[model samples]
Target chain A: MPHLRWARALGASALLAVLLASAACGGGAQPSSGGNSSGLQVIKIATQSPLSGDESVQGIALKNGAALKLKQEYDQFKAMGFDLQLDPQDDKGDPNTGVANAQKLAADSQVLAVVGHLDSGVMIPSEAQYHAAQLPIVSPANTNPNVTSQYKYPEISRICGRDDVQGPVGAIFAKDQLGVKTVFVIDNITAYGTGVANAFKQKAQEIGLQVVGSQSIDKSETDYSNVLTQIQQVKPDLVYYGGLYQGFALMLNQAAVRGIHTKWMGPDGVFSNGLVATAKENAIGVYATSVAAPTNLTPGGQKFIQDYTAEYKENPDPYAIYGYDAMGVVLQGLKDAIQKNGGKLPTRAQVRDAIRAITDYQGALVKVGFDSIGDNIYAGYYVYQITSANASTTGDAKLMAQYNPKGELVSQ
Target chain B: MSSTLQTLPQLVLDGLVVGFVYALIAVGYTMVYGVLKLINFAHGDVFMVGAFVGTEVLRALTAGGRPLSPWALLLAAVVAAAAVTALLGAGIERVAYRPLRQAPTLILLVSAIGVSFLLEDLVRLVESIHLGKFVLPVPTVFATVYRIHVAGLQNPLTIRLNSIVVVVASILMMVGLTLFVGRTRPGKAMRAVAEDRTTAALQGIDVNAIIALTFLVGSGMGGAAGALFATQYTLVTPYMGFDIGIKAFTAAVVGGIGNIPGAFLGGILLGVLEQVGGGFIGTKFQNVVAFAILVLVLVLLPSGLLGERVQEGA
Candidate 1:
């Protein structure tokens, strides 16, 4: 009878311990329940980026800048009655993975908004899910106009100008600035490449320049000597390329070897300082179009640039500034929306609406303004010229000129 | 009319420069298969490891951004990369293949694929060390050009000093190796082992050492090829070696596996085909053109460019 009583007592105590542990762990409790302990509410913002892959260099830069901005705004957000935490996921710039990552973020309740899917190829597939799930997405680098305009419900937004605007600027420069009468347009045949090239060709024809030849190339194949030779035979005054830095650098070097001295131009995809670093002498006299001004010149962009250099010991690229701006807009939207909705945690729909209604949301890079389609209305473009004696050091190259949205050269 | 004449030679010249690099990488694939009778599928990953080694060596030597003379950096990178890669190659053989010495051909082939995956993941881990937007430094001397005027049309010409260096270095290495294998004490042992492992062991030769040496030499060449590849292409990435590895293997098989000179011949030929094909057709179909040529060569010459059959002791 004594042993039986001891066993019964042990069983009762073990069950009580489990119940106590469960309550302490905060399981089976609602966050919405009236709170007794009030300090700062930490909301999580997550995004998918190409952390490793072909575009990883740009993606990493974006990640670092976004992290810095999130850190800098934490105190400000806390004072505004909330706290911000950044969650980053690596999609490797793959569309399939990007979609899955979006779904994963959708399932997470704490995730208030997102700021990613850098590649337009990835963005096209992932945006619908984020929209359906009511997650606000702000792409830092994707410039494909259709990413926003073509979609009926766009949870996607950006701080950078569209390719539609930048492409025409490049074409106009080739036409009026360089006074090139004949042109040959080439693209790497990606959605971004083709879209930008089509815009450039249309504007070039409209600006009274003859499109004598056009060709398509793949990114994998390195040797462009034959294409350069053929393009040389066509004898165009300028060769316009629509591709990323990898193929662009190879083609430029091969073109120089083949004696195609025609001036080369490309969109933001090929505008990287890395392109000049790889192609060197071949990149001389080449012009490129970009959506963001040099980070050194923007209002809040300079501070981020300085901070990045101080931390990483290297100057930040243009994408870094845009990335910082994207984070700023998302966090700012969340804070203002939360304040407006009865000083309570607003729903994801309220956050999405807040992001779309963002007008003159001040950012380090630019004053971000989103249209109904989630396009940045205040975004502008610029043109850069690359001059390098060698294919390694990029700091030696000069940023020759900046162009506004209307293609007029901005006075220095 | 003069422009047209100038364009062909220019195209051909550019093609040869590009072709030479491919040939150098291809030789490693061909020579290893000659005696082993199996393709070292992980050869490309070996090349990639060599490149990373080169980058590290260059980074160490050029610490504090004190620019050493270009030639000094080049010499250090090439030697260090090759030595490191040779060591890695030998290590791979011991860890992966040596244990499976008596395994079937399919098993060995599967092991090679497994080794390739292992090396790639290892690279991905190492890649995280250099955080964010790392631009590799390349010397201008490699891609510098001297314009040549032909038929009153100024043709911009590039003289790849690196290509000349690659050719000379590969030649010297090959010559030294040929002499070592033909004249040295270990050379005979290696040859004897290649003939019949059972008989060579009976003759008191260490079969393991001979196999390790073969890997060391082949991997050394691969390392040299990788360093030159970076200088020639002016770009290096973790996965860059994979497609190139496939191309090199194709070259080796086309030229008769395990044959040194045959691999060289096959590599240059493959390069020429790629160039001519890309020129005639679009660059988009260059891979198709290279594989098509390989198929055609196999149809015509089943044993490969220089493969020979041997009869057992009469």
Candidate 2:
């Protein structure tokens, strides 16, 4: 009798929970339509990014950037009797999640191109699925050289410059610009983090800067007291963190708490509003080398800033422009492929080839030309010093210097 | 080796505060396991809920334009988090556990996991809808950094005032719960229920009420820990609880499941070991070291460091 009573109660509560969860899920689910012979041939450009974790600010903006592009071009495509849809997939910034999302997106025949994977670590692994599906992905932010150089997957390409170049840019900037002689490096213990850190270390050693020590931090963990103490002990001229913005923010704050105020620098992964907001006053004077060029400085970029702010009611993250450029590359490829195929929806291979074939194609922000291995020939890197707490939000950090894709300094 | 020795104090100091938090959440796991013989897998999600609640309260207060003192803001966050999470824990018990009170252990375990998942998704849903972003960064309150110059250390040992607040708050909660369970009448009744449920019921003690009381107290402590954790660590996400929860659960097990003081000991031990090991080996291996220490403890002392104490008290 007691058992039955409890069972009935359990069933009722479980049902209520199911209903609530389903409603919540329903709110997030997009209407995924099948590829049918409708008036407008449907095409989905998927974005793989960490839409929900620590990196969500950058990832979401990356997704939004691509989505905004798709939205804008939707009318143009529709006029040409083609449907352009943005499929934003939450990778959660996990390799497994990204791979799973890639698998799902890859299986969908309608998904011809992708514009994402903010983390190179996520991008590297997920590229296999996209390659198998012949789906071309134009990365908005992944900078690890291995992302394109190692894999050499024509399906994989990024609008952002590689970490090898970005790393040295920071090293050169540190030695030449900031006048820091000794450097201590730390990574987020991620593929992207470790890769960038190694590159920076290599360049630091080559440039005759003292490489005191290096520490690897798990990106998920919050506490950085141990590393902070270590940093204090070594007394580096500058502390370079090759990690995401969130980890860099914590370390910067933690280091500040300990009076360990060596100059702080990071790769583009640390270029976001979250860092400034979280680190607050601690973030000021910290430098981050971004794979993105200054967007507000360009006229078209100004319009993009206005349009994106008006559309999303949020200022685009630093990588948002990268996402716009990535999607721009993909959309260009899609258009070329469609035209090549006589105004018909091209096969996935056609899109992949067309994307890899891009040369001198200018997006709203960056000019893109994919090398044979899908490395953007015209990718430019910029160093920005956080002059204000809201620098990342406005992408208005003081542009310290610019670098070509080859790590050659282009301007002061 | 000298360098490692040099950073030992910093490592231990860093570990202690987090260990106290682990102990706080561990007590929730231990208490529920003691009373109901259930792991209460949802406890971690409960902790996450508390973090969100605390963060939201701070956000609300900050946005209200009247800036309160740091301590006051912290107290508000902790108290609000405790209250909300206490209710959530009780509600979870009522809806999820009470219904399956007579079910098999595996069934109860399943229900616990289901509740855990449901709570995470629910929080995620609520946060996503409300904030349009589920990763809620905790607003700053206590930003004062205290530097202690220890003899033989080149760099002064830096301690965050917030971390000290967390440790003091955790200790206070721990002591309060310890006293409540050891001295109070309801506490004795709960212990009796843990000892023998049928006998406790026959002795004029409401067994269900005692169990629910246990959940409320334990969950309140966990929520307070969550609030403290959010304050010390500026980021709070829906999935944040899973890793910390596992570590806390490990702390409970190492402390000897169902043992209160053991959870404390286990938490501190695990935290120190993790940080020290991580400091030497690598920070990436902190979890590995913590769990390795747990396995070593379990293998050497199967019942746990304070398993003997578990039988003496709930």
Candidate 3:
């Protein structure tokens, strides 16, 4: 009886967590999805994102970015005797909402591909639904290694770099550019943070940089002084934080208060306007490595910035070019599949296979190429230093260096 | 000296700031349990709501770079949050707990959990609609940092101005509440109700009003704590309350469920122990240390440190 009471209590608390979690998801619109496909053999691109909640800013940008690309490719698809239309779904950033959106997309016979779901946790679970429907989905911003490596869901392909590669890219830059020798690592104890931190640590050691210490902190914890104290005691040359912008910003704020000024670097998770907004001046000189290059860094991406700005009338979030690139990859698959089908509309399976078989397909920011596991073989990482300008503009982080997937220096 | 030993003073100082916050939230739990003999599980969410409201107020006041003293801004935030959360606490008691007063303990617990979830979701929905963000970066109130140079350590023991305010404010609330319960008429009525509801009614005390007042004061304290916590920590989310609430509840239990001073003592002790113990063990085990102390206290002193003053209600 007591155990039952405990079970009921636990269940109640779990329900509470679910309610809170669900309330935080987003949903959005635009002429909306499922529009008339010009009366031709319709090809639908479904987008999943939290279109309406706190994450809507990023999610809507992703959807709009993908939409802009799909809209531009519409005439080409129409000329090929097929109709191209976008179907945007608000996954609301909740797993349940994302899965529901996935199910809806799966049921649409015309829908052949998906372009989003900003959070990795949301997208990873939705993969099954997408895979079951024989619908290939391309991730725009997910950096988790498991995105491609987990189920190796051939239906899932991502245009962004993975967490493992992003971490080592920072280490490579540290040694080559900053001449970093000694380092300390810190993580938020979550899967993403721990994975990135560990990768950075392993790569740092592999490259002969002495790793003086490592520590994990709880993300929910407000006070990080205990860990900061540990960092003070260790006195490493540089500290690498593998966490989101919020936690890293807090650490930077606390470190400044403590007068513990060692060079600090973090993975892509720390690259955001929120970081600059939260930590302000402390964010200056902080090094971060991102899977996606700054939108203006490449010629193709520079064009995307202009087109996207002209289209949306606002500068795109960092995820916009990624969304553009992802949808571009999907459109490429549709083209290959249709051509292989002798200019006829291809089955979803054919399109999926065509996507997987991509050997070299260059997009706006990245050259799209998928290995068997749906990872872009040519995915490159960019290292950025937050400047005073970055504090005002959303994605104005100064590009410091670029690295190949193998951690070899590509550009500086 | 060992590195950790040199780090001890800084760690303790950091822990004490958080400990005071825990004490503030714990007093809410202890007071409610003292009078009503119910856990009021939604108390944490109430604290979270206070934080959001406080942040919003601060944001509004400071909009367009308004020139305002940090202390005045903090006062405005704290006052607004306390007023809003007090009303919420009373409303919750009236709607969620009053009708279920005679229900089984398990049922009351379930209701409490339901109320907790409802508050979290409601705040989330409201925040999303109003501010478009459930996670808010609280405007900084105090930017000054004080560095204390010690004899042995190379790095100064750095303390944030906001942290001192958090400690001082919590102490004021704790002492004020103690004096109220010990020296006032309404406070005596509250004590009488806790002692024996029927007897208190016979003694011409408005038992229901007293119970509601207890919730008002307790929840007000929680709101002030939330505001202080927001300023100290710098960011607040809808679910931030759950973690801190659980910790405060543990502090409440460890300090003696119905005892005020016990909650304060327990909170301070738990905070320091968690930091000190976490230093010895892995940092990941910091939570383990807090809960381990709870388990140890429950096993050795089931009644808690100051002892649950069920009849005392102070």
TM-score of chain A of each: 0.85, 0.94, 0.83
Docking class of 3: medium
lDDT of candidate 3 over B34-109, digit per residue (tens): 8888888899988998898899999999997968899999999999999999998998888778767888766878
Please give the lDDT score at residue A252 for candidate 1. Answer: 81
Model 1 chain B lowest lDDT segment of ten: B132-141
Query: Comparing candidate 1 with candidate 3, which one achieves the higher TM-score?
Result: 3
- Model 2 per-residue lDDT tens digits across residues B28-48: 999999998888888998999
Question: RMSD for each model, in Å, please?
Answer: 9.1, 2.7, 5.6
**Between 1 and 3, whose DockQ is larger?**
3
Positional deviation of residue A402's Cα in model 2 after best superposition, in angstroms:
0.9
Candidate 1 lDDT by residue in tens digits, B201-288:
9999998898888888888878877776776665667777788898878777788776666777777778777766666666667668
Q: In model 2, where do residues sit more than 4 Å from their true spots?
A: A1-38, A391-395, B309-314
Candidate 3 DockQ, CA atoms: 0.54
Q: Please give the distance, in angstroms, between residue A278's alpha carbon in candidate 3 and its true position after superposition.
A: 1.5
Rank by lDDT, descending?
2, 3, 1
- DockQ, Cα level, model 2: 0.66
Candidate 2: deviation at residue B89, Å? 1.0
- What TM-score between 0 and 1 does chain B of candidate 3 receive? 0.96
Model 1 alpha-carbon miss at residue A213, Å: 4.0
